[model samples]
Target: MSILINIEDLLSGSIVEGTRMEFKKGWNPVPIMRSICAFANDFENEGSGYIIVGVDEVDGKPIRPFEGFNPTNLERVEKELVGYCNLIQPSYFPRLSLEAVDGKHVLVIWCPAGANRPYKVPDDVTAKHKSYNYRIRFRSNSIIPNDEQTTELIQLTAKIPFDDRVNTFASVTDLSKSLMREHLQETNSKLYEESEEMPLEELAEKMNLSQGAKEHLFPKNVGLLMFSRKSQEYFKGAVIELVEFPNGLENPYTEKQFEGTIQKQLIDVLAYIKTNVIKTKVIKYTDREKSDRFFNYPYDAIEEAIANAVFHRNYELQDPIEIRILPEAIEIISYNGADPSLKQTDFDKGRVRARRYRNRRIGEFLKELRLTEGRGTGIPTIVKSLADNGSPVPIFDANEPERLHFIVEIPIHPKFIEQGNNQVSDQVSDQVSDQVISIIKYCSSPKSRQEILNFLGLKNHSMNFKRNVQPLIEGGYIDYTIKENLKDRNQKYVATDFGKSVLIKIE
Candidate 1:
């Protein structure tokens, strides 16, 4: 495998320490080996991570670049680190290279993602290694999963959705009767008034909180999420972690983690985003536009995306569904990908619907709560609402794009969204050919691929549109008004901020 990071950037002090990259002042045999193990078994990470021994990390930023390794002893360090990699229980071998950063000698260890995952430190290696055996990288640190976390990870081998399975460790008493009664009232069923008087055991069973009958029973993940006071106790990462990074990616302007009932978490997260992250823009009233009030994104779109994350995310993976708010966009990230037998491109246009659900039981419950349609309307609702609000096309970015992780990124609105936007950077204009620019300019408003062809006084050439217009869409210079409805005959394209930049460049 190739080296995980750019040597030039590291020398220039551009890359720093984080989940995927780490820098050290000097080679410490034990800690360096532990980090290597963590990087190898990076289940939640996108790609493999890199370790640079030479730079000092301060305040979460790499600084004070130094000669990382002793040049005369560099070969010896390599031999020792390689030995450590071999000593890992599952065995992790990294690409060891001796390179120079700013004339300072440094050793770069490129740790590849583990082929045999969930690697552990060998018991015979050392007591330090044994004590901190199976390690996973969280942020920048190699963390030991506590007893509950270990149990949680092991229990996921059944490959069932957490909400669908019975919680073997939790008993019927763990689920609160009051929470069940409140849930019944929220449903507004004819059974609502009667549910208060109903025995707790029957109520629990009715909610599918347990298996079997009166005597033998246990709480399910869904029951804990909805009924338990500390649902996060069992479902560790079920919380919604909201962080607004106004200053930069590394700096958080505000941060909050919401936990409780699944539905409550959803509601509170939506409220928090609307109150804090949602920005209102005032436009000078014009003859063309009457409304003065314009929000950064549609409220409904935000709600749909968050609700979908809660209902659809793999709760077996111990990572909170993270909502990151920034000036440019709002990113709602869920752990793991959806099941698709097809190739990555099959879901690229966002049309592939899984034949079954990863969370069927939880989905059904959300439907009863009126939180979601449970008809796969989650994505459609998010896409339509954003488009209606004059936002850029919503994107579902995934690390394994073909695997289908649900990551809804809703870009904050630029001015004049429906007609497209105000001018953007000319970076894309320089990237495209003259033929593409003309088609974009001709689209004063939204235009179809065929309409543009007619405007250009050319007969239909399917390949020509694909070659010219398709690139524009991919470059983020232009977008379809109805991205989810790409098959629609009336589907039209409009220039984005970046697209407008291309037009201004042409002018």
Candidate 2:
């Protein structure tokens, strides 16, 4: 945020504090200091926050026609704020500037994020101040969190990723050397040229799967996912539960749990989707010599959706990733939700989905395995692939309070039910007789009885129209607009899906 807020802009009533902006009536040391502390200790990755003094707020909205800070108190307030910082345990120096709106002024303090994090708010400005109270901004308010919330904030402030933490109960031997070696070779990186010769602990450290201990190394969560032969032993929710519902309800026709190293699990799940979930069909148009091919849903799109769930899901959560295949659609639901740093409107506005991965180590490994294109390219790929395959765009729901699971719903391909039943089959040897082909190829519009006969250079619409146009209509290449009322004066023949497919093939 800049060191200035335009009075005109503020008066325009368009400014919403959202997650970062705060409005204060005056430089009340207690509340203002708390705001500064919260901004400095911000852990939800909201880069930096701004605190504006002199603008009065009620019910989270800034009211109009109110006078801002008195121009006289600006310097005095700055000095007092600077003095308060000195009395605090750790110092926080903010960039202070006086901005004028309609000749009335307000102090804008820019509290940027500092490297020395988890700053505490002093109990008072007393010389013997000793309290180490912490505060954080949640939405528009600064809150002193409860014990559990405090712990989560501390972890977020330390930047301790869930995937990198050491699983103390699991030994380094839990990691499988054979699986690590296979992954290294599959990725084919020069960094792993001597991977086979490296000790298990060293290899695990190299892949960020294990961290060295004072005596014995321990496997990290990411390491367990990659090299551990029994990852499910520690992480009970690590498995992906795949279920196919025949009636689209709780009754499962087939249920399977894929539990193993994540890489292996992803491969197994993808193979299962291709074999069981996806249905391929051969389509022939009219009496064409060749046919067309498509599937119930694009396999590449499915891979993107499933990979996104596994790679970015919050593995610390107790729930497993779910792949539910129903008659109408395939849904991939991941445990936990999206980045809390962003607002729901941000996702609705088509903002960038990922600025940081929930599991950076796992995501990096997937990228190395060519399972994903990192740097926030996965969602766009899924969208484009679905659209190109003539399917509706996939729906993604993140941070829904009720469900609290990231869901990707891909509708079943339209052709899934209508495949072989399509009017034209690929293998029809005489789908359209030669005489009928001559009639359809020459007409742009739907030709009537006499019009078709004239185009075929026949004298009458009697038997000539029957021999030529009748075959085209009955063979499924063409159809009359009013089939039941063919005797109507406006009745005319038009090409069907079978005919259009054939026309393109012949071209």
| Root-mean-square deviation per candidate | 21.4, 20.6
- Give each model a TM-score: 0.49, 0.53
Residue 138's C-alpha lDDT in candidate 2?
A: 70
Range of the 10 consecutive residues with the lowest summed lDDT in candidate 1: 422-431
Query: What lDDT score is found at residue 394 in candidate 1?
Result: 83
Extract clashing residue pairs from model 2: 176-227, 209-223, 284-425, 284-426
For residue 71, give model 1's deviation from the true position in Å.
90
Question: What number of backbone clashes does candidate 1 have, counting pairs of residues 3 or more apart or in separate chains?
Answer: 2
Task: Score each candidate by Cα lDDT.
Answer: 0.66, 0.68
- The 10 consecutive residues of candidate 2 with the worst lDDT sum are 1-10
